[model samples]
Target: QQQVKQSPQSLIVQKGGISIINCAYENTAFDYFPWYQQFPGKGPALLIAIRPDVSEKKEGRFTISFNKSAKQFSLHIMDSQPGDSATYFCAATGNQGGKLIFGQGTELSVKP
Candidate 1:
C-alpha cells in the first residue's frame, strides 16, 4: 500500500488557462507529500509539499489539495504559462523515511 498513482499522462493548456493534475496513494502511513517538477535533461526539483495534518497548500501559482480520508491529492496550476511546461511528479513518504514513493509523472505543456 505504498503506491502513488497519477493520471493524465500528458496535458496541454493555454497560456492563461488552468492546469490540473491528480494523484492518489494507498498507504495511510504516508505523512509527507511533495510535488516535483522536472525539465528536459535535468533533475526534478521540489515545487510544493503538504503534510497530512494540512488539507491544502499553495505557493505562487502552484497549489496542492489533499484529502486524508480519501487518500488522494491533486496539484492545480493557476494561470498556466509556457514556462510551466515540464514533467511533474507527485511523491509520498512516511515519517522519517528517506525513500519517496513517486507517482507516474504527468507531462504538461502550456502553449503560448
Candidate 2:
C-alpha cells in the first residue's frame, strides 16, 4: 500500500489561529515523509519533513508530527496569516526507489 490519505480538502482559519492538516499512509516501507506548500501559479516547495525516527519536527511556524506506528503524519501551522494561505501536500517515499507518493492536497485560506 503506497497511498497517502489526506483530509479536510479545504480549510478556513482566522489570522493568528492554528491550522491543522492530517495524512495517513499504508506503506510501511516509507521512510521519508515530507510536506509541500504551493502558492498560486508556483511549484510546490518543501515545507517540513520528518523521518520515522523523529516523533516531531518544527520549522518557524510550521511543524510536522510523525507517527510511525500508526502510519500517519500531520502538519500544523501556528499563527496562521493571510499570507500563509496556500495548498499543502503530504508525500512519502520508500527504499524501493520510486517516485514519491503524494496525498490529495489541502487548500488553506487564512482570513485576516
- Best-performing candidate as measured by lDDT: 1
List candidate 1 stretches off by more than 4 Å. none
lDDT of 1: 0.95
Model 1 worst lDDT run, 10 consecutive residues: 93-102
Q: What's the lDDT for residue 96 in model 2?
A: 69
lDDT assessment of candidate 2? 0.93
1-112 per-residue lDDT for model 1 (tens digits): 8799999899999999999999999988888999999999999999999998989999999999999999999999999999999999999999654799999999999999
Candidate 1: TM-score?
A: 0.97
Give one digit per residue, the lDDT tens place, for model 2 in 1-112: 8799998899999999999999999988899999999999999998988889999999999999988888889999999999999999999998666578999999999999
Alpha-carbon local distance difference test for all models: 0.95, 0.93
Q: What local lDDT does model 2 show for residue 39? A: 100
RMSD of each: 0.8, 0.9
- Clashing pairs for predicted structure model 1, backbone only: none
* Model 2 misplaced stretches (Cα beyond 4 Å): none
